[model samples]
Target chain A: MSELVDCRGLSCPEPVMLARQALQETGNGTVQVVVSNAVALDNVTRAANQMGWQVSVEEEGEEFKLSIKK
Target chain B: MRDRLSIIFAGAVVGLLAVILVLQGNPANMGFCVACFIRDIAGGLGLHRAGVVQFLRPEIIGLVLGAFVTALYVREFKSTGGSSPLMRFLLGMLMMTGALIFLGCPLRMILRLAGGDWNALVALPGYVLGVWFGTLFLKKGFTLGRSQVQTAVNGYAGPFIAAVLLILLVTAPAFIFFSEEGPGSMAAPLFLTLGAGLLVGILAQRTRLCTMGAIRDLILFKDYHLFLGFAAIFVVALVGNLFTGQFIPGFEDQPVAHVSSLWNFLGMTVVGFAAVLAGGCPMRQLILTGEGQSDALLTVFGMGTGAAFMHNFGLAGSPAGVSPAGQWIAIISLALLFIIGISNVNLHRKAKTKDYSKAS
Candidate 1:
């Protein structure tokens, strides 16, 4: 099953780091990350892109949904 | 090591400071104010000759020795430097100048408000606003560049200076400045003050306590390690102050403070910006200096030299109010910060372009 990681209220490099760490630990899985700020969302997207993971972002008001697959 | 342990350490340090302040007759929020006390020390050493505020504070000595001892114990003491040290020194100067104009460091400003000094309330928002702008610059890719590892002697320079200052404080040398009256004179006893400073330094070192870093971390990376420490300090200090009967509520005529709301806010705005730019609060900078961060050391010297210039040029504010010269310095400093941001952004853009070209 795909895992969801809600990183809302988390700041830069954190959501990114958390997502990466989770993906590594989970070892090839789908993950969804929620970020409260544009910067964090952008950072997560960048990290996902860099890691060659499939990513889709959903905007829900002030929050963002970043889904990634490895 | 658990992160919770760091918070406990910070709480203990705040507790120790409360005890010290209670013993010394300082108001509850009066513990561990590097900027305020240094101003007093400046007057005590006859630097500004501000009457009624002269006192040779033991806290500064304590902070240096405490951090130095802890760093030694942890084997983290590595002296290195040779970065743009002089520039750091100048920034430190601007930092102190701005802080004095505001009448407190970020920690003290928060502490002051927690103790019910509404004057600090005015400064707090300005600080956050300044940090916000700094964050924008950071988002735009502004950086101070990298600091290369230097010989151990470079780090020694700061401690050596601190040691000499301590000796001068004790000796009351003619060349060294002192204030005859003002907030400088109203100081806690020597040993107790130093003890409080040492405890703060040790805890701060262990926990990486920094008020500015706390705000910045929350703003930048949502890292709570530093902010938690800040919260602990405030909570502990608030309780300590209340128990000690040092909690005086009101904005008008708080001890060692002024009431110019606009300048108060703007002053901290400058401090907040500089602190974020420099990567730590004044106390953090001092601890880093002790721990062999040459850049931090340079910032300390910058503060001291800034103090000298502030007093010499009549730029330091008083309970009376901010000087025109002080106002001008703040404006110029802000302008310079903007210029630095622009250059750093341009450089980052260039780097990104080159990297992209190579990758393609």
Candidate 2:
């Protein structure tokens, strides 16, 4: 099962930082991260990638869906 | 005491802005709004193409050159470097985006209401609330970081750019950009506009005048030194409008304004918070750029880019009301600001670790 962390509407590093913390808290297989901005999505993906997690980014309107798997 | 020279300096600045508006045939109610004028310039340069609002206002160009000349005279001109410049640039963009959405900067909101634009009434409170929150963050120690002195080349950079713009203003290049039929299209004569800009530029530089700083200082330190200048602008503008028969009372159909109170308030709230964080309003930023502060220049560029985005995305307000897109951006922007504020604050520290270290 994938846990979701919705960070839509948060600006800049916050979205990515929150996703990292959530991932760490879950300490597990898969996590879904969502953000309202393209910049934030890129940050999330970059942060996830650094942690050696597999990630996919999907766009919905102005928001992004990032599915990360460990 | 001559230290009180700020009052006379600010008064002179107000008087200079008045002359520019009167000479330009702008709604006498309006004068020297960096945000509004820049919006008009964007419209003029065909950036946005918003009709009835395109004009290559000479006052803006004058502001830069004016400060440029004064900086040269006072020997206060020194170029400098800023840390996190790109981030500051982006912050400026967001700042402008928020200001345009509300149809005024913090300075113009007061001007708008002082000129009897009731829509501005809504914005005043929001501005206060936003500044209050910013002050809270400041109390908790949020800062963008310090600027370092740089090579003389950096100080001359903005002056060089301003000189080029001045050249463009004078030469009227055959390929010069201008709006065909928008607020950008409306304009006052070159000399009159520039003269006004120069006068205010000198006066502002002398006094360290800033509308946003005026209010911020008052709230943060209970200081009135700067607020006096702001109060003077309102008093002078109100009187000038009354004398010129420019004071029209109404929420609807006000020049360069909209009627949505909630968005108006929210828009300026964003501007106020951003201005506080950024350290000055648009006009103050211009002055700083003239003095060779590259960070302020970045902020100005950010504001210009933000204006472009606001127009392109239909996120700017009209006389009728705020755009739905603008409202969405406002909501998202506020949340983003909150997150930035909270996370960057560095609140939780092992007792011995010290939060002041982050601050210092």
True contacts kept of each: 0.00, 0.00
Interface RMSD (one decimal) of model 2? 14.9
Tens-digit lDDT track of model 2 for B265-312: 889888888777777788888887877778878888788778888888
The candidate 1 chain B region of ten consecutive residues with least summed lDDT is B351-360
lDDT tens digits, residues B3-100, model 1?
A: 56766678557755754575576644667677766666666566665565566667776777778788879766766555456656766776797898
lDDT score at residue B13, model 1, on the 0-100 scale: 71
The superposed Cα distance between candidate 1 and the true structure at residue B37, in angstroms, equals 2.8
- Top-DockQ candidate index: 1
Lowest summed-lDDT stretch of 10 residues in model 2 chain B? B349-358
Q: After superposition, how far is residue B94 of candidate 2 from its true place, in Å?
A: 1.7
Ten residues in sequence with the least summed lDDT for candidate 2 chain A: A8-17
CAPRI verdict (incorrect, acceptable, medium, high) for model 2: incorrect
Worst lDDT 10-window in candidate 1 chain A = A6-15
Cα-based lDDT at residue B166, candidate 1: 77
Stretches of candidate 1 above 4 Å error? A1-70, B15-19, B41-48, B51-56, B174-178, B346-360
